[model samples]
Target: MENTKQQKTNVSSKTRTLVSAALFAGIICITIAYFLHIPIGGNGGFVHVGDAFIYLAAVLLPTPYAACSATIGAGMADILTGSANWALATIIIKPILVLFFTNKSKKIINTRNVCAAIIAGIVGTVLYMIAEGIMYGSFVSAFVLSLVGLVQPIGSFIVFVVIGLVFDKLKIKEMIK
Candidate 1:
């Protein structure tokens, strides 16, 4: 039937679109992680603009692809930055950071996204502290590390706002199709 064939075609097209978005987001996330970092922590914690892309991916793409993009892209950054052990944590943390974000609306600067960014900053900082504490074998030391890590999400929130606004103005999300 034509309807059945059209359904198949739609599915195929959507799959391609999602995959392409994921790949492009991953590449961009990697680039941001590599270059835009502020060394503000004592226990090897640093602020990076990578989470902006992660949030962007989550906002612009579906959950599966957005999580995948954040996980792989952020994981790769850890591996490349001599923080290989943190790769797994990054994979887990990056995706989880966007768990509360629902990209249901086309409005990028809406309430859902702002709340998402704020919650992401809080949860991301706590999660990193726990992970780094376990890795460093000291909860206290991890707390200190988290102080530095706090900058990441705060900085990311700022980046996410500016970037999201720009994307909206430029109709970047619409152009994806």
Candidate 2:
């Protein structure tokens, strides 16, 4: 009975911690995406470091939690920043981005994650092109315009790798788990 009670307490504590971490990650996503962005092209599109946090969240949190964090964070940033047109697309794409990543690995910068980042970047760019094409009523134009979107993933990959290295060195994943 005592062991069971202790287990319950541990579960509850872990739940709280995860919830808080997700919320914090979401906030950081919003902040980085909204405030620290470089306007690109004539579209209201911008490149930001927010995806780095999304990648980090995917590496650290469970899939569901990471998806939620990425979706809410990226989606909310779009909505709050008057890019509501992209909000729906972001909602759909961000979670998909998380699917390419895994928190199962002990090291954050493993082969799977490296490949996942590259694949996620390509997939994300393609999805954004499709979304923009639908919105603009021109697939050709969207494809041309969304070329700038590739820069985001490249930048995010750099940020993720650098940050991931620090996190791995510090054993942050083990500590959190």
Cα RMSD, each candidate: 2.2, 1.9
Candidate 1, superposed: residue stretches over 4 Å from native: 4-8, 39-44
Can you write out model 2's per-residue Cα lDDT over 81-140, one digit (the tens) per residue?
Answer: 667878899999988999998889999999999999999889988999998888878899
Please give the lDDT score for candidate 2.
0.83
lDDT of each: 0.79, 0.83
Off by more than 4 A, model 2 = none
Q: State in Å the error of residue 43, model 1.
A: 5.5
